[model samples]
Target chain A: MNDVLIAVMMIVLTIITYKGATLVYQRFRRMYTAPIILSTVAIIIFLLVCHFSYETYMVGGKWIDHLLGPAVVALAYPLYQYRDILKKMVLPVLTGTFVGAVVGISSGLLLSKWTGFSELIIYSIVPKSVTTPVAMSIAESSGGVMSLAAVFVMIAGIGGVLIHPAVMRVARLQGQIGRGVGMGSASHAIGTATAMERDHLEGSVSTIAMVLSAVIVSILAPGLTLLLL
Target chain B: MSKAVTIILQIIGLYLIYLLGTAIQHTFNLFIPGSVIGLILLFLLLSLKLVSERWITEGAGFMITHLPFFFIPATVGVMGYAYVFKGKGILLIFIGLLSTGLVMGISGSVAQRLAGRREKAHE
Candidate 1:
């Protein structure tokens, strides 16, 4: 296939898969049916079954990837909408994000070291708590593999979405702000999406938390890697 | 503006912000992602009334709501690293899940305590 043709096909395929998965998620309302999880699984299966190479797939896939930058920037809309709440809870949100960033980075570094993973893996995992674009930059600057960082980030996000309700129940976490901050800071975008489904207040707070955690982790990840690694 | 024009303008505005972010990152040698810089820029623009929300609201809402769709391509790239998983995928999963749980627990508890204190103070 021509490169442009393949790229166009990939974009159409991606959107269809995502929309289809989203419908299933709405119908089932199950964690396993979450659009991100489902679309990734479905795409992977499609590729494997058709014997498509990752390179050929990415010729088109890269177009979607480029949009991720703009999508992230569009997050400012919610942040702008929720600015009043953000101003009111600035102290708690900042403190919570700072502490979460520290805990996430330190724990990731420690675990990777204990497992004797390479420096690259350690660097990649350090920024796993942040959203993908930020995490990729942090990983690159910190000498990690960007692709690996993206994978680790996806795992953290999916894991956070899956485990959050249970964690909330067990920990008895209260307050929409608390739940939002926890989910946003730990899981990034996916968790925030899930949070959005639960409540408007939670969703807005999650957006703030996601942005705040991204900024904090971006600043701290490299320094933490230098200090710990 | 028509819906199509609104979407186009919004995208152009966003792309411009992204470009500004890229410039700032290059100039300052900041570790921050350009998209994040763009986010901060957009936030400032919206807050200051420099950029009317109505112009971008429709498009931004659409993008944010479908945020997961954009991520599908990158997530699918995971298949490229089958060897890493084969080598110590379990270890990676263990660390990722463990850290996620720890982060959720710690942040939730801390934010809850702080929020509680604030409520009490307000009361």
Candidate 2:
């Protein structure tokens, strides 16, 4: 199949799968039944039942992946629209992201070392909180498995989804923007989704936090690793 | 005629937007991503009131709302290493799983505190 044709088809399928899962989520009200999880399951089942090769899936799926960039870029409008709020919030957002990045790295490395895992494993584990593309790139550069980095990203997403609600409740944070930003900065996309569930402003702030978290961690992780080592 | 031309132009514009994102990432040596920079650029343009939000809102909203699904392709790529699943991968998975909670919980707390402080200072 032609790559462009495949990309178009995949785009259609992505839309269908996502929409279908969202409808189910609306009916069920379960995070476990969330659209992304369901859509991923649907795709995986389709692949397994039909025995489609990953490469074949990639031919079409890759195109949708290409849009990931555009989606990130598109987030700017919401962030921009909320710029006044953001200007007031910038110092805290920056401080929180940097501190979170540092703590996440330090704790991850310390825990891995204390557990007696190999250095290679620690190298892979420490960068897991960053977005997948950046984390994977760092993993590759630092000699961790790219595929493993992808798994780490998934784990991070799922972790964010499950725990962030309880965390927010414990903090007694009624401020939606703070709640959402915290979620996104830590969990990335999944956290951002949770934020969207709360409200638009929260979602937008979360998206900004998620993006900022990735950018900051990508720069800091390597330098921190060097200093720590 | 102009309506059709506008639609065509918008599609072209979106494509150019994506490409520009790629170019910036390559050029500026950013840690985050070129696409993200493109998003920031779009946000900046919107904030400056240079671009009409009405024009891009629909597409952007669609993308942002479904952002989680975007990771599927990359995650699926991980299946290629099924053969080595037992070795160190298990540990890697555990580490990933364990640390994510730490990352989100701690970061969320810290960010909240900072945002709160800033809010108070503003008052």
Q: Interface root-mean-square deviation for each candidate?
A: 1.8, 2.4
Q: What is each predicted model's overall lDDT from 0 to 1?
A: 0.84, 0.69
**Candidate 1 C-alpha lDDT tens digits along A1-229:** 7888999988898989998999999999877788888998999999999999888889999988887777778878877887776677877777887899999999999998988988988999999999887898888887899989998998888888878878888877777778888999999977887777676567767777788898888888778878987
**Alpha carbon deviation, residue A116, candidate 1 (Å):** 3.6
The sequence of per-residue lDDT tens digits that candidate 1 reaches over residues B38-65 is 8889899898999998878888877777
Docking class of 2: medium
**Total clashing residue pairs per candidate?**
1, 2
Task: For all candidates, state DockQ relative to the true structure.
Answer: 0.68, 0.55
- Give stretches of model 1 more than 4 Å off: A140-143, A222-229, B117-123
Worst 10 residues of 1 chain B by lDDT: B114-123
A29-110, model 2: which lDDT tens digit per residue?
7767766667777876777787777787788788777766676666676676777877777776677667777877777777
At residue A220, candidate 1 shows an lDDT of: 84
Write candidate 2's Cα lDDT for B12-123 as tens digits: 4555787887787788765656766677777777777888887776566666666766766755665565654487656655665567666666666666776775555533
